[model samples]
Target: MKLVLNTFFSFFLVSTLFGQQYRVLPIESYFKDISFFTDSSFTPIFPVSDNQVNYYNTTKEQKLRYATVGHYIYQREIIQVIKKEGAIWASPILDIQSGVERGDTAMSQYLNVRGLRIEGSMKNKVFFSGSFYENQAVLPYYAQQYVTNRGEFYPNSSDSSYHQVNAVIPGSARTKPFKTNGFDYAYATGMVQWQVLKSLSVSAGNNPIFVGSGYRSMLYSDNSLPTMNFRVNYTLGKKWNFQLIRLQGLNLLRVPYASNGEALYERKALSIGSIYFQATEHLRIGLIEGGTWTRGDSIQKQAVEGGFYIPIPGAATIQEGINGKSYAYLGLDLNWRVWKVLLYGQYGRNPYSKSSDVGQIGIRYWPFKSPNYLVHVEYNHTSSNAYKSSNPRINYSNFNLPIGHPMGAGVDEVIIRLRAEWNHLFVSSSTNYYLNQSDNYRQLLPVYEAASGTNQQVLYETFELGYNFNHGYGLEIFGSAKLRMVKNPLQNEQSYWFNLGIRTALNNHYFDF
Candidate 1:
């Protein structure tokens, strides 16, 4: 830790270029709706951090000329604790929700979350942000099942017998039972970026990487837990931008026990490279490539091998191919804006197999180009072998969750979402339909097999209405209802759940699957 800090400080002293403080908007639809509606020409690649948005107005302080206590209390970051050449801002994160289910098993559910976020810049050249959250919740039935099944287990310390062990929360790590049917877990993410030159920037962080502009991304999505990563972003001109990221991922399924009965997760390294080109005013295109490989003892001793650090797209994949353990992916992202609506699509595949692939198409329609309303429709399909690896340790996943899509693989899905905002009031609805057939989808080394029990269809719908009291950190009160139906040869089930709560909605909590 001390070495990293010293290195960062050394870079900070030498950075001579003038750059804006870098901060990314939350990677959730609720936080990005207004911005997308206002700026239709924005890139389809998600989590637009380098651009300006309404919610995160860094240039202007959110203070009225005649500011009072209420302005400081409800309208802005709780504290601008330090204001040198730059400012240090902090806010409390809170989400308290309660709900009840009326389905096969009628019961009550609740969520309690508390945390803090701090972000700022040093001399407007080096930027940093961090947040830590602690959460406890009793989830709905379907979501609970997803969590329970994806958890990792280890041998018992006393008897050396493996049984039901830790259940992982989605986008989080291991969890402990909170109550009768609840989970308690926590996660933290931080980022530091340095603008090295006029058109170059470097950053390192622990956060989910999102690479497409839809409800779900075929290339990569922030559906899994964040991992340690280093990224370099460069721009040649107005028409071309490039990014390279190197990250370390974990495969919980192959954990080796230490002498003290501690589980040591297997680690892998991934290198991702992408190029975006603004071909014309109406069309934009992006090409992405990546490769992942297990970090054996020879390579794990070092942070990254010299050859693996090549930034050119496909270099790592080509190098790994010679070693015959290549887990490479290639994808294309495209978006065209015409007649006031944006059309987007993605095509992704494992380069080694013809059948391991994913495809998606979607549209973001803003009726009459209104900033208050949005309608999104999307279709997605994944082949049975997509994201699977013969060597399970190098699958396209981290901590047992798929990094590409929330649903593991071998599925067809259609999703429709609608959103409207009127002053401080908002309402939204989402519907999803899924056809799943692969029994081995969730396994690391998945292979398609005909299993009658695996064939099931699901339909899910959710609606929510909320009133925003503050835009800073998105403090709002909301009421929502969800309906889920499952049909298969063995069983048919229907479920309904309703919730009411106030929360500082900042991150995405995906339970729709």
Candidate 2:
């Protein structure tokens, strides 16, 4: 652990001493800039007059030459136009990372891309977005690690050896334990927007539905169904806005199922929609219903959901919602002049159709006002049944479902985190406590798990520090340590990692451009 910590800090110090460039800019400045009319009283630049023409030449040609018009001249500049044109796009990033578990060595190298575009005019518009990721890694078995099950319980025993598991399908020569370098998957979606009236517009696309303000929701992630959708949005009064949407499922990815039989599962397709009303400058109310078609095949159903946000004293904010799929939740976010806080709590029945009720709550606080210097502290708690059988199974029996199997259940955790950022430097520390009760240890070990299991109460801690240079160069160093106080006493795990990243421009690199 000491060696790992020393190595992590050394990397960050070296990088900070000789790293590339890094700069901070406002979020709004990141988007395109457009100035349609210079002045309300001004006319077009064409058709010049004698005196006006001379002035135009003196102001535009002889002087700055910023722009030219008749006597009524206008000076307007468009910035960051390329970003809005959707002509600039980025592919996924590649990172090399490594870790140690119980003195066992684990390593991974992966590429991931997340891209989005929004382009449209009063006449027409189109949006495209998606995620593609490929990961290759060396992993350990479940029994060797603590895991959580569908019922939210931690397990104690390891499954049979990988070589001993069923290797072939029954009555057939098909390979059973399909093995490969790692996991690979991709998802893409697009949407079009059209103006139906001066104050109304309609859009259709394949997108996830986010109806509420919580971090996780039955409708938040694309777990159950991926659907094509259509929506109509309009403006009523000066402060009122409305929207309605309908969705249809489309299965494109292949998922595995336990039934063994090749089941091309088909969803009856569900319809879902939402309406948002901006009652005031700081308040919004949204009503949602039906479940959009996701890219999976666990269930073909829909339900109602609603969300609300309001700002009160001390900049306090509250949001709550109940959606179909036996899920319900509520959350709060507040900002007091010197202290920023976020408090959230949620409750649901079989969030993923598992046979257990799940509940979670978290709180975060930030101190300091300057954007360059800040401190944050957070705590989170989660409790559930942790049973495996009640968990949803991956519908891999069909080729149209998304990748990976259904997530197993049985997770109970408490996490505390602290972070600080100053200038180009950032540091964060976190500690996690786990309680396992099932046999799904493998599912809980890897950052990504495929099965269910139980993980007994254990303590895990991590620390990270990084620096960004002004020349688009970035470097980060981090380390983690995990200890199991119970059981056969697996070796206390400790590892260190270093990352070098760069953001290069394909064309012009200026943010002002």
TM per prediction: 0.86, 0.47
Worst 10 residues of 2 by lDDT: 29-38
Q: Rate the local accuracy (lDDT) of all candidates.
A: 0.72, 0.30
Question: What is candidate 2's lDDT per residue for 320-424, written digit by digit as tens?
Answer: 122222122222222112134434343433224344444445444444432223233322232333211211221211112211111224444565656565544
- The candidate scoring highest on TM-score is 1
Give the C-alpha lDDT of model 1: 0.72
Count clashing residue pairs per candidate. 0, 65
Output candidate 1 Cα RMSD.
7.3
lDDT of 1 by residue, 233-281 (tens): 8888877879888888765543444646565765668777898898887
Off by over 4 Å in 2: 1-80, 83-181, 186-203, 207-219, 222-339, 344-357, 370-410, 430-432, 435-455, 458-460, 469-513
